[model samples]
Target chain A: MKRFLLISLIWPGYLLAQDNARQIEMTQLLLIKNHQVLSGNKQPDGLAEHSETVLRKAERYRYQGDFDKAVPLYQQAAQLNPKRQGYIGYVHLAFLHDYSRAMQYLNAYDALTPTFDDIEGNNPVSYYRGVIYLKTNEFALAIEQLNKSIGDIERKHGSEWVNYRYYVSRARAFLATSQPQKALDDLDKAVANYKKSALAYYHRGLALVQLGRTAEAKSAFQDAQFFFGAKRVEALQAGQAVIPEDQLFPLYESEIEAAIDQLKLKP
Target chain B: MKKQGWRNGKKYALPGLFLFGFWLTTTAQPLTRDQLTGQWIGVHAELNNASLCPLSTYLDLRSDGSFYLGMVDGKAPPKVMTWAMKAGQLRLDVLTYALDLISLTNDVLRIGQDSPMLFRRFQEIAVDSTAAFQTLNGRVWETDSLRLSLFANGKLLWENCQTYEQTVHCWQLARYGTAVFLVTRGNAHTCEGDYKPLWQLTQSGKQQFRAIGWNGQAVATETFRLVRPLKLSEMPPANEFQRCANCFDGSRYSVAEPFLRRYQPMLYDIRKAFEQYYKPVVASGQSGLVQIQFAVDCDGRMGRFLVKGFDNDYQAKSFDPQLVAQLLTICRQKLPAGWRRDPLTDQQQSDIDVLLNVRLSNGTITDVFL
Candidate 1:
């Protein structure tokens, strides 16, 4: 028994040493071995895996744009866990860009928490609904939805605690309705919340342009340009696949430049 | 008092502190050259808190200090670069990663912070590609979900029998010792990520052939039944097959510029055009999103259009032909003439890939996702 125990303990160390030596020797050979190969056994039954597993699997397919395989799995995930509905709704809103369907899922998710605003992914249900309404060009409905989210938060914790993007989104809605004064108020709040936001400055320029404040519009556009360049540099330093701030707001440097040029022409 | 203080503080404390520091440094030691020099298969990249997308890429590190990186099933030649460990930092090509950013355990290597890329140690199984070619060349095969046609001229066509999505690719039977892999390489805008899954040839017969490959989630053996022999009259349509002139890194160009800012006005016009051209089919229970993905070549010509449909439940389904055709026309031919040239030609930019998703309520277009 002692001999067996000794061998068991020594065997692992011996094996590890051998592995290291073999790796070193293989390195010397320098033979080009193709590392690309499908390495896995047959897929396990979906019923055996957890809901999280199913959802992850669905995400893999969706990421590749294989909706034929992704959809049924997403359905399976929702059936497995009701809380996943909110995430699925977010996917519809953000990734799939299906606003109506997103609203349906968001509504379904919100029904679970009837008394209070339900959180989906990172944002609340009202926030997603507002974005959906904005996307669908229902400016009035978007403002109403945005109010539900922004008002409740501002009431409790004051405007400082609310996300600056929420204010920007509401400002966008106000701008669409020619409510330039209200838009400016929201823009001021957005700027105060996050001073370096290129998105806020760009929209602020737009509001100023609408109010015919040509000089202020030009200055806001210039600020927007500077911040946009700074943001791009930050994005580049963050390396590949880092989404830029301008991309999140779906704004463009060209738009700011165009706004500036138009304002210059006005003067 | 001085002697007592030295005994209590300096003597034991100095030695003890040195030993503790030594242990800490040794425990967090950088990975040795031997541990890193090997073949690796990409597992997946962790994106945004536990969400993983399969990474179909491979890394091969040689003792000669040179490492190769490429898509697993790609025809694009592998990129070769020298690598070394310097000052406790691991260098892969030009990108220097801190020692803490990389970890290897039980044949798995992970690199990076936040979205760490995972790779599994690859064990090569020798198989003759010449033998594999004899079985697969110049033949049409069919499975339940897909139909594959391998032409003798190094071209293959993959058709999703269910979705009716047809794609053409360059094919090669690659040998790694005793294992044979059927590699299919796609164009710049191919949805399946530069290339499809690497299929390892397992069994072969006159009428049926089987290969182990990824089937959406996990590896499964797909049996292909011989449909027919490839005819010489069938020509590979180079013109029809859209490819980017200079799309070296598959995701780099597309992901960096998901949408060209200069095309913003044109994009708006396209949306307006779609809504105007759209003739509502007015079918009951046919509400969904139709997503169209296409590529604009470096020369500013758009081609290689792929369409996908999802119902109100976000389930995959087909939409009315009228709705799909009208949208395709606007995207393909109805773009404003100015979109044909890259706006920022002075900077020498590459091709741009665009994905347009439109939500349909019955037959009417409701929303355009840019």
Candidate 2:
């Protein structure tokens, strides 16, 4: 009787403990899948059970574009569990565009997950870093980072996966450094991959003009106009254009016009 | 006493069995890594706690252990991570995270603890040739004097106005040995008669195409380019053929009518200026159509002005071209400031060709149009 009583009393409690542990584990998995940080005070089960709830709330906030509210929750989740560093880094880099904070999170992620290889070309850390450098006008550093990113992507995903934007950015950097020929080469690749972008043709025109290829420059300018006009018309028709009047016009219209004028005036 | 003890044992046994059943229900069978090597799409049930909307998500796990996770909406880039089945749990490299193996089957996979989400294995279906044909159908290819329209039903219409020949044929596009060939049969009009032509097609670039003969030589005078589609409403009236405004090279102004319509007001203003200055010239028995050629540069400035007189049938009239040019130069200087500028080519201030035709009958200004 005593043994029966003891077993009955302890069995439910043991089952309850197991259920709780399973719940925590499941919540951790959910958090991971959702790209949220796993966190919480360590329970006797060695799982941060509360972190899952925090991450869920953070994700909700992030989805709603409430970054001010979401960032704190993500930070808290990261604090509770260090494993979330990578996801937090991605959120900061991709969503918030906070380079410094993203870099910090990425560094922490690198420290924790030191064995992570970027052989799949899916990792956007280097790409994001390169973009940040480009935006900041650190052309040399931008080129270095973008080179690394492109190399990794080409090796893993083949040349097809290396998008036109990468080439355009590198070309812009080359142009800034006065490497007009290199810029032209990159612009050619960019145009080949995605011909609809007016900016590529515009830059190509600039590069051609720099090289004193007057006829080619004129053709490139005309192409830029054609593509820009087409896109402008498309945007206007779609009703998604913020500025309807400007949407049908190209960026740097005045600059291109001036360049054409200069070319015509050249003896 | 023994009966009472047995009853107590039976009571406890029921509770024990209940606990074991609960454990069995909650603890799912462990899944092997091989079982996960496929694309899986599922719903995240608790994505938004406030709303009951479940967000669809995808998990593409390759045999190489690289996995991509993304929302089904495709708004976000897929997150990449290396995954492996470790110690009966799934370990992801990036997050340094692990997922407890729940339940996995050939079709359905369930993962999570308290509220497990279910996923379905993705199966890819083969695409038929009809789908491929749809991509190339209803497009027109053109060159200087040749136009070829490909229809969805495999009908091809080739018009060569220069040769005064129109060919209607049943066409089939086939790929063999790394080359796409256009095989045509039926009443294809040639100088000789109806014939069949098997032309091997090669794409020079996105916009350009080259058709070669069976002997592997380039087809004579055959250069095909993609034709930009224009609405019927944008086409010029029956008797009026479209040509570039300022040039005599006979190149057509193929831009949409809506684009040209935007400059009507400015062209109207220029007309009024012409009437103010040249109305007297028309009134003085100099009644003829003067063709003025000018370009609006990217800076919205006018340049490269030329003028000549032509009769109603578009033949060069007997008026002195230099006199018309001199008059146009004077009028160009007096032209108004409201050229509006071509928005499309304005960034580089691309030169927009403007052609004006001023008409006069019996020394009176009759009409003006572009």
TM-score of 2: 0.31
TM-score of each: 0.52, 0.31
Model 2: reference contacts kept, as a fraction: 0.02
Candidate 1 per-residue lDDT over residues B167-280, each given as its tens digit? 666678866546677776544243222344567677777798887664545445789899999974674464553443211223211221223434443455666677677777
Kindly report which residue stretches of model 2 are placed more than 4 angstroms away from their true locations once superposed.
A1-56, A59-67, A77-87, A110-123, A153-161, A209-215, A228-267, B1-370
User: All models, DockQ values?
Assistant: 0.04, 0.02
- RMSD of every prediction: 16.5, 28.0
The recovered share of true contacts, given per candidate in order, is: 0.04, 0.02
Q: What is the Cα-based lDDT of residue B365 in candidate 2?
A: 55
> How many steric clashes between backbone atoms does each model show?
8, 7
lDDT tens digits, residues B244-322, model 2?
1111111112211212333443444565666677634333446556656665532455655666665543345655444
Which parts of model 1 are misplaced by more than 4 Å?
Answer: A1-49, A111-114, A237-249, A257-267, B1-287, B294-304, B309-323, B333-355, B361-364
- List the lowest-lDDT window of 10 residues for candidate 2 chain B: B243-252
Q: How would you encode candidate 1's per-residue C-alpha lDDT over A2-109 as one tens digit per residue?
A: 533443233222211222123222211111111111112236455434667788777766645566677778777877877788988887776667666678788888
